[model samples]
Target: MTLTEKLTTEFRQRCEGIATEKRSLLNIRAFEPLPADLLATQLGATILTPKQIPNLNPCVVAVLLDSDQWSAGIINQNPLWIVNNPRHTPARRESNLMHEFGHMLLKHKIVRFDPDTGFPLRRQSDEDEATYLGGCLQIPRRGLLWAVQCQMTQTEIAVHFNASQEMVQFRSNVTGVNI
Candidate 1:
């Protein structure tokens, strides 16, 4: 779905507020990069790989280790254990982690798996909200504006934010801030 269709103006503003609040809690300026690792640390969230999941089935571990299709997911809520795909690149990993963090921040319910198919039964609206909030957390509107003001290129902004070039472009498009 298009960004506008998924996120309302008020919802977008709320996401911006959340991002700003998170940054403030970390003592990070709006223009500064908020690394996913740092945020996870602050949130007391533990990041793990498939191998770290104790007593996992060998077949499941093999599948997780070999696949690049999955990004990340929240495996535990109380202690906040997130399992990220080690196969993805660093930039993609950051984005994946941010997306997981978005779900946590928004208090999205854990996706339940279908007993018949073993596929996750997800709520599209929740996924959309998490996606939008993830983008906001990765590249806040104010941060995009600051980067633009500094005459940063798309690659520069991506590198600065530890985001993919596509994410930087998406932020620019959603925020109506040309880079």
Candidate 2:
């Protein structure tokens, strides 16, 4: 199913509310940028590269370090250890961490990987929800509107928010706020 089919209007608004609540907790204004690293710290989460994971197989680490396909994941829940791919751009790293944080905020259960494929058995709705929430966390609808009011271009907004231009455009498209 498509993302639109998985996520409802109320769910989207709830995600926006979650973003606002997180910002409030951090004492960040609606128009201000919320850095994912700062948020992770506030959440008592430790961000780690694959290499930082002790006892990890060297071959697995090599595969992870060499690839850009993977983003990030919460490897541990008690201490909230998130392993992110270091090969990604800074903006991508932020987005990746935010997506993982989205899953955390939503209390999504960790999905087991398929033994045959070695890929996580993700639920489409869960992924959709996390993706929507991640975008909201990166660029809240109110923040987008504020940027638009300030006459910021998509590129400028991306730079201001420390996000990729594509993310800014995606936020605009989803929120129906022309940038």
Best by TM-score: 1
Residue 98, candidate 2: alpha-carbon lDDT: 91
Cα error, candidate 1, residue 16 (Å): 0.4
Model 2 C-alpha lDDT per residue in residues 1-179, reported as the tens digit of each score: 64655679899999999999999999998789899999999999999999999899999999999998888888899989999999999899889999999999999998788999999789877888999999999999999999999999888999999999889988888888998
Superposed Cα deviation of residue 164, candidate 2 (Å): 0.4
**lDDT (C-alpha, whole model) for all candidates:** 0.92, 0.91
Residue-wise C-alpha lDDT for candidate 1, range 1-179, written one tens digit per residue: 68767779999899999999999999998899999999999989999999999788989999999997788999899999999999999999988999899999999998888999977888888888888889989999999999999999999999999999999988888889999
Assess every candidate by TM-score.
Answer: 0.97, 0.96
Q: After superposition, how far is residue 113 of candidate 2 from its true place, in Å?
A: 1.8
lDDT of 2: 0.91
- In candidate 2, the residue pairs with backbone N, CA or C atoms under 3 Å apart (3 or more residues apart, or in different chains) clash, namely none
